[model samples]
Target: MNTFKTEIVKTKEQSKTLAIIVVVLFIIANLYIFLIEKENQNVYLKSISFVIYFLGLFFLFGQSFIKPKPIGFFEIADTSINLRLDESQDTLLFIELDNIILKYTGYGSWWTHSIYGNKNYLLIACKNGENYNLEILLRNRSMKNDFKAFLNTEALQEKFQLKKTKNTTCEF
Candidate 1:
């Protein structure tokens, strides 16, 4: 038997903070355009932007109210690998470690804007039509080692059905 526990990645406080930040950014940008540029834009454009912004904001805020559920869960015998995201499920895509390409490089200028400053991400690339990339932000050396071990494990291979493929090319 396999037992798995699903955890909510973000808390209510985190969700609220995210929503606030997004709203603040939108307001700041609009204010900049209205005050600095003084460009009289169309009402339709303003309305559309506001609608999109609020819609996204609502989605973020709404997350806090809802109970967190596992997007997918994988089990091997008694062990469970609860995937926080839907794409991690084996049903969605049968990912093969051989098909995945790992890349390690210094953080670029754009990366500085990210929450993890100059951190490493274990980039897992797929070989199929779906060009999905899993970026796991490395926190410590132990975590990195554990992640690598998990990826190389037979249980993960069986769970994900990792296969060896000669073709590394992925078609969009």
Candidate 2:
């Protein structure tokens, strides 16, 4: 079994930059809506925009407190992928993975590199209709490469498939 530890990148800078961008965009959006679209102004859309911005700000600030911790190793073998969280090694889930959404791009979908740095993740949907997500904080890309290699192995050959979506490189 291959074990990889989680690595957390410097998020303060990223967060700061993101916050600035979001605020600027929010101001610009509101200005555009009120100034240009005045004739067709809808109260509901404006309210929703305010709500979304407020919620977005809340979550953005919340990121400072909620840090994802990698519990244990992803024990990969021929038959299944055993997820062992913590020292018990009892295996959290025996992943009989059938489909993988290989979303190297997208926000709110996969690959969240903006807010959480050094955090790598995998979203797996198994044959039995269970969806699993593994978020590990690692310093480098080795873990990502290793995981892809594991998925490409002959043991999991025909059953596995990759999925693509229309989204940005990373979601929050």
CA-lDDT, candidates in order = 0.40, 0.52
Worst 10 residues of 1 by lDDT: 163-172
Per-residue lDDT for 110 in model 1?
A: 30
- lDDT per residue for candidate 1 within 1-172, as digits (tens), equals 4332222122123467776777776776456445644367666766766675666666645443343232333322223333345554542233432344433322213323222212222233345544434333332334334445555555455433232233312111
TM-score of each: 0.29, 0.42
Tens digit of per-residue lDDT, candidate 2, span 18-125: 777777767755665567576676787777667656756665565545444545655655455566655555333334566654434322212353333343445667
Superposed model 1: Cα runs more than 4 Å off: 1-98, 105-118, 122-128, 154-172
lDDT of 1: 0.40
> What is candidate 2's TM-score against the reference?
0.42
Where does model 2 exceed 4 Å of error?
1-67, 71-73, 85-96, 105-121, 136-139, 164-172
- Residue pairs of candidate 1 with colliding backbone atoms: none
